[model samples]
Target: MELTSTKQRRAAALAIGAASVLLALFVDEPYVLLVAVAVICICIGWEAGLVAVASAGLLSSVILFSLESGAIGGAVRLAVFVVAALALWFVIKIFRTMSFYDRVYQGAGPNIADIPGLGWSAYPDGRLRFVNPAALEYVGVTADEMRRIMDGDDYHWTQFVHPDDVEASMARWHHNLETGEPVIDEQRVRRFDGTYRWFRDTAVASRDEHGRITGWYGQMEDIDDQKKAETALRERERELRLLVDTVPTMIWLMTPAGLPYYFNKRFLDWAGIDAVKEEPRGTRQFASHVELFHPDDRAAVKAVFEKSFARGEPLQHKGRLCRKDGKYRWIDSRFEPLRDEDGTILRWYGVNFDIDDEVRAQESLRLADERLARALRAASLSELSVSIAHELNQPLQAVVANAGAFQRWLTADPPNFNHASRVAQKIIRNADAAAQVVARIRALFSKTEGAPHAIDLNVVIREVCDLLGDTLTSSGVKLDLHLDPRLPATTADQVQMEQVVLNLVRNGIEAMQNVSINVRSLRIVSRHQNDGTVEVEVRDRGRGFSNPERIFEAFYTTKPDGMGMGLAICRSIIEAHYGRLWAENVETGGASITFSIPIRAADSIHTITAATADSRMGAFRD
Candidate 1:
C-alpha cells in the first residue's frame, strides 16, 4: 500500500497560499494571482478550501478595482476571479469524498486488535469472523483450535461460555442478531484449563452507508476480580443483616439526614412497622416513624432529632410509642452517629427499648410520697389540736363578752352615748381579733393541693412559732425568735413550708420538756445566706440527735409514740423545692436542724395571691 503524507501536503499548500496573497497584493495582473490562489485552496482541503477561495476572490477584486483601470479591465478581472473560485469548489468536492474513504480504510487496520482487552468480530449470521490474540489467550485457546471449534456443524462461540451462562448468552446473541441491536452482557466464560472467569462483553452492530447491519464488533474485558469482590461484599451484607435481625433490642438505620431506611425485625415487631411496607409515599422514613410516637411527644422528638442531626450529636428520648394493638408503651430511644475515620457522620444508628415498667414504677413512687405527706400533715395537726383550739377560744370569749357589755350600755335608762360607743368599739376589736385567730388556725391546717409559691421564710417562722406558743408555755419551754426581715423570698408550697417549720418547732419544744424552766430554751432563727437562699434554723437546748443524718430517713425517729414520718416529710418537701435540709449537733448541748431554700430568680417568680399571714403576735395568754 502507498502511504499518503498529510503533513507534507499541508505545508506545500500553506506556502503556495502565502505566495498567492503576496502576488495578488503587488502584481497589477490580478487575474493570474487569483488562479494561483484557487489552486492552493483546492489542494488544501474541503471546507477550508472554500473559505480560502472566497477570501482570495475578495482580495483580488479589491486590488483590481483600486488600480487606475478602465471599466473593461475591472470587469475582466472580476470574471477571472469568479472562474477560479468555481474551479476550487469542484476540486473541494472530490477531495472531501476521498478523505472520507481514507478515514474508513485507516479505521479498519489491525491497530484495533492490539487494544488492552479482548477484541472480536462476527458476521451477520452470528458466526465468529475474527478473534484477536487477546481474546484467544483469555479463552486459553490457539488460532487453529478456535477455528476448529467454529467449523463444527452446531458449534458457536458461545460453546466457550461456562455451562451455567451458555444458555442465557446464546439467547442474548440470537436476540441481538434478529434485532440488529448491540449485545452487552456479563457472563462467565470457560478457559481451555476448564476454569471459568467473569467477562463483560459489549458489541455494537456494524452498519454500512445505508444504515443496514452488516456485522458486529465488540470487546470482552476480564472482570473476575470485580465479580469476586461484589460477591464477597454481598455475603458480608447478608451476615450483617442476619445479625441485626437476631439481636434482642429494636434497632434501625437511617441516612445522615435522619431518614430511616432499614429496620431490624425486632424494631418492626415492636412498632408493627416494616420500613419497606409502611414507608410513607414520597416522603422520608421519619415521616412514618413520627406517627409512632405519642402525639404530645412527637414535637419534642422531632425537635431533638433535628438538633442532633444538624450537630451530629447523640440523642436520647423517652416517650410513648404506639404498638400494633393501638396501645402506647413507653420507649427509651437513643440515636448515635455512625462516623467515618475523619469524624464525618455517614449515617445514624439507633436502638429503642421498652421502659414502660420503669416509668410506672416512678409514678407509683411519686403517688406514695404524696400520700405519706398527707398522712404526716394529718398526724401533726392531731398533736396540735388542743393548743390550736385554746388559741381560738380565748379570742372568741372576749368578743362574746364585749358584745354583751355593748348591749347592756345601749339599754341604760339614760343612754350614755360615749360609753356605748366605747363598748361598741371593743366589740368590733374583739371580733376582728377572733377572726384573725381562726384564720391563722385554718391556714396552718389547710390541705389544698401543694404547689410552689414565692414566700418570705421569716413570716413562715413567725406564724409557726405563734401557733405553737401555748404548747411552748405549757411545756415550760422558753421560745426565742431571731428573724431577719431583710431575708429574700423563696419559692415553695406555703402549706408544706409552714408544716416543715411547725414540725421543727414542735420537735424542739418536745426535746426541751424534761429540762428546767430557765434552761428549756427553743430558739427559731431565720436569716439570709450569701448564696441567694433563705435559711431557717430550729435549735433546742435539749438532748441532741445521736445521728442527725439518720433522723431524716423515713420511719426513723427518737420519740416512742412518733410515726417517724415528720422529719422525713419535711426533708422531702424542702428538697422538692430545690432546698437543702440538714441537721447538726450544737456544741453547747442541743441539736440544730437548718433548712435553706434557694431564692427564685426574679423573672421566674410570680406574685400569685395566697392567704395573708401575720408575722407578729404580742403574747400567748394561759
Candidate 2:
C-alpha cells in the first residue's frame, strides 16, 4: 500500500507525532522519535520527497529526560538504535508487495552468555578471556572469581598445588627447562577463595621465527575425582594386607607366572621373617616369587603354569606352593589372570593356601590305587595261570592219546602231515592269546598322551554317558539326556571337559549314594536358551542341596574326602567359556547344577568397529 498524495503524507506525520509522544513518555531515547519521523517522510517520498527536510527538523522535539544527560542510558540507547533501524526497514518494506513485520519479528538474536561448554583464559597481559569453564566450575568458582584469581598479586599457581605434589611439580619444571619440552603435571591448584583441589596443568614453550622460547602457554584442569579413586586404592591395599594377616593360613598373593607380589604376615612368619617391610618388601611382587619356589618342583611348576599362563587354560586346578621351609608343604594355589575390558591380560592375582595335609592324603590315595591295581593284576594273572595249567594238561593228555595214533600212522607208512599242521596252528593261537593278555594289563597301567580338541557340551555329555554306560547300569542309576542339538562348539580341549564331566557325573553318583534302589535317578540335560546361549543342567535325586550357592565356593563341601574343588572347577570352566554356572534345588527333589555358554555370533557385537564407516546398513559416514 503506497501513499498516493500529500493527504496521506499528512496522515504519516500524525503517526510519527504519536510515536514521539510515546518516546518522550514511556521510552528514553530521542533517537527513536527522530527515526519514526524519518520513516514517515521516507514513506511520503512520491508526494513529499522535497519536503523530507522539514520532517527531519520536526524529529528533534521528542526527548525531555534521560539516564545520561545529553546522552542516552546504555539500555535505552541500545533499544533506541534497534527501533530506529527497524522503523527504517518498515518504511522500505512498505514499497514491497509483502509485509516486513513477519521477517523482522521472526529472527532472534544470538545468546553470547550460553556459548556452551567453552572455557576462557587470558595471557598475562590482562586480556579477559574464557578459560576452561569446565575447570572453572570444577574448582567451584565463577568467571568473575577467576578474573580475581589471575589478578591477585599475592598467590602463585604452585601456591595452590598440594604440598605432597609440589616437589614433583618443581622437578617437572626443571626438566622442562633442560629439555625445552612441555611441562605437564597432575597436582592441586588454588581457587579464588583460597582452597586447593586436584588440577592437571601443562606449560608448553612457545617459539617464534628464530626458535627462541617466548612464553609458556599453560593449561590447568581439575582431576580431583581420579585422585580420590587413587587414594582409595592405596587405602584398599593396606586393608587387604591387614585382612590377609588376620587369616591363619600362609596367605601369599602371586602373579599368574608364579611371581611373588607380596605375602601377608602369616606368609612372612612362614618365611622366618617378623614382618615384611616396605622396600625390601620381603618379596618384590611377581617374577621374583618364581625364584623362591623349591628347586626340584620349579620345572614341573612352570610347565603346569605355562598351560594356563601363556595359553589361557580355563582355570582348572589349584595346587601347592612350598614356603620358606625346606620341607615341601602342599599349598592350594590358583591363578586368575587379570585381563582388561578388551580381554587383554594386564596382570594376575592369585592366592596360595596351606594344604600340606591334603597333599599327603592324595599321595597316600595314589599309592593305594597303584597297590590295588597291582593286586587286581595279580588276581587276573592267577586266573590266567589256572587256564594255562588246564591248557597244558589237556595238551599233555592229548599227546599221550595221540602217541598211539602216531605209532599207528608210522606203521601204516603214510605220514599224517595234515594233523600235524593243524596242531601247529592251534599252538600259535594259544601263544598269541597270552601275549594279548599281557598287552591289556600293560595298557591299563601305562601313561597316556593327551588327545585334545574343541568340545561341544552336547557331545561331551553323550561321550561321558557312553564311557560310563556299563558303570551306570551296574549302579542302577538311569541317565536321561535332553541335550541341545545345535550347540556351537567351544574352544576347549576335550580332555578338560572329559575330566570335568567325569568328575561331575561321578559326583552325581556319589551324591545319590543315599537313594534307595527303588528311586535312583541322574538327569543330564542341555538346551539353547532364548538368550542365545547353550545351557547344561545336571540334576540328581538323593539328598537335596544344603546351600546351593555355597557348594561352588572353594573348599566348601559335605563329603569328608570330597576335594571341595569339583564345583569350584565347574564354575571356573563356565566362566572361562565366558559363561555362568550356579546350583539350585529342583522343585521335585535333589539339586540341579547348571552351566551356560554364550552363543558367539558371527561377528563382534559392538555399536562400532573398524569397518563401521563402510557398514552396509548404518547412518555413519565414512
Candidate 3:
C-alpha cells in the first residue's frame, strides 16, 4: 500500500513538471518553472524537485538555441538555472528537517501524545527541552508555563519533587548528568492534586555518531501504590520483630543447616553484652552454641541437635544453661523446622523456657522424700525390735516361773524328786521354745525361711485381719473376706506367708484411707487354682497406683511418710516361697495386688523348703 502511495506521488510530481514545461514553452516564463520546482519539493520530496529543475534547465537551453542564440550563451544560462534550482532544493530540505525536529523537541507530535506515563526530553546540558502533554497535565501546568520554568533554572524540576526528597534527588540527577550515565532514581513527585506520590524516573543519554550525548530522553512512572505496599510490608515486619523481642521466653532463628542467624531481645539479654555484639562469630554454630550448656550436658545436647537437624525433625531437650551471672539454670529448649510445601526444611525456630524453679523444687522434694524414707525405716526397725522383745518376754517369763518352781521343789524339806524332775522338764521346754523364737526372728530379718508347713491362707488372712482390726476401725476401713472353704492348704513357710498377708492387708487398708467411708472396703480373696496353686488377692477401693509396676520397686512410694519397703518385702517373701506377685489397676476402681504360690505335696515340702532357704540366702548375698 505504501508503494502505491509513493508511485502516485511521483506521478503527480511528473505531471506538474510536464505542465510547467509546456506553459514555459508557450508563455516564455521562467518564474512559472521556479514555482513548479518549489511545489514538487514540498509535495514529492527534494529528489523529485531536483529532477524537475534539471528538465527545466535543459528545455530552457533548447529554447535559447532554437531562437538563434549562441550555444555557449544558452549553456551558461542553463548552468545558472541548474545552480539556482540546486540552491533552492538545499534550502527547502534544510527547512523541512528543522521543522520536523522542532515538532519532536516540543512534544507536539502525535506519537509523543500516545506515549504512556509522563514523557520528557532534555538537552545535553541537562536543560528540559520538552514535557509531553501527559507530563504537563500531571504536573498541572501549561506548555508555556513549563517552558518558562525549564528556562528559569537548571534545577527547575525540583519544584515538583517532595520537599524532603529534593536535595537527594537533585544530587543524584546532577551526578548522573555530569557522568553522562543513565538516570535512575526514585522520589516522591507532586501530583496534579498537590499530593506527593512516589515515582521512579529513568533516562538514558542519546548519543550521536561521535558517541557524544546529544540529549536525554526519559519517563516518569507512577509508583505510589507500589511504594505504599512496600512501606506497609516493612511496618508489619517491624511489628513482628518487636513482638518477638519483647516475649518473655528466649527465641532464636537458625538456617536449615543449624547455624544461628537471629536471637530475640530476651536471648541477647540473658547471654549478656558479649552475645549482643556477636563476638567470635563461631559462637553462632551448633557446636559453639552447645558450649553454653552445662559441661555435663553439652555433649548430649549437641548430639540431639545434630540428629534433629540431619533428619529435619523437631527436638526437645532439658538441660542447664550458663547464665551471664555465671550461674547455671535449667532450661527447656525446643526446636522445630519450618518446612515448605514439598516437605523441605527452610529454617529452624527455637524457644528456650526457664524451668530452673521447677527442677529445683523437684530436687528438693526428692531429697525430702529420701529423708522421710530413712526416718520411716528407723521407726520400722524400732517397732520390729519391740515385737521381738515381746516374743522373748513370754518365753523368758515361762522359763523364770518354771525355774522357781523347780528350785522350790528341790529346796523343800524332803526332796520331791518327781515334782522337781517335772519342773526341770518344763524349764528345759521353755528354753527350747525361746531359742526357736530367736531363730525365727533371725530368719525374718535375713529374708530366709524356716521349714515349710501346711497352712491355710484363709487362716493367715483371718489372723492378719484380727491383728489390724483396731487399725481398720480407727481408719474407718471395712474388711471383706472371700475365703474358699474347700481350698487346700499350700506348703510354704507359715511365718513368711503370714507376713506377706499382713503387708498386703495393711497396704490395702492404707490405700483406702482417702476413699469415702462407704467405699473404703479392703477385700482379701483366697482361691485354689486348677493349676495346683493357691492365689491370694488384696483388693482396695482407692486411688490406683500411677505406675503399677514401679510401685514394687525398692524405695518407691506414694505416701508422704512411707518407707516404700512394705511391697518390696512382701514381694521378696512371696518369691522365696516360689510364688509370683503382681499388681494391676481395676477397671471399675482402685487396684489389686495378687500373689500365687504352688501347692506342693506334703512329702516334697522338706526339699522345697531347703531349696527356698538357699534361694533367699543367695538373693540376700547378691
The candidate that wins on lDDT is 3
Runs in model 1 lying further than 4 Å from the true structure = 1-108, 153-159, 253-260, 270-321, 331-350, 356-439, 447-544, 552-556, 561-581, 585-622
Model 1: per-residue Cα lDDT over 525-590, one tens digit each: 888888888889999999898888688765566887765656765676566566789999989898
Ranking by lDDT: 3, 1, 2
Index of the highest-TM-score prediction:
3
Error of 2 at 607 (Å): 72
Task: Count clashing pairs, candidate 3.
Answer: 0
Candidate 2 Cα outliers beyond 4 Å, as residue runs: 1-181, 186-196, 244-246, 250-265, 272-303, 307-311, 314-322, 332-350, 357-622
Task: Give all TM-scores, in the order shown.
Answer: 0.53, 0.31, 0.57
Error of 3 at 99 (Å): 6.1
Give the per-residue lDDT digits (tens) of candidate 3, residues 1-622: 3422334656676788668867877877554576677767866566677787787677766676676358887677667777887888888878755654453345533576566788888777777777777888898987657755754656678899999999998888889888998999999989889999898999999898999988888899999999999999999999999999999999988888999878888998897635546744324667767788999998888888888999998999999998889899999999999999999888899999999999999999999987886776665565445545744664576678778889999889897989999878877866776787677667655645356778888888886686566578988988889899998987877666766787788788888888789899888899999998999999999999899988876557888976465576567667767789999999999999999999986667665544544544333222
- lDDT for each candidate structure: 0.72, 0.57, 0.77
- Two-way lDDT contest, 1 vs 2, winner: 1
Model 1 TM-score relative to the real fold: 0.53
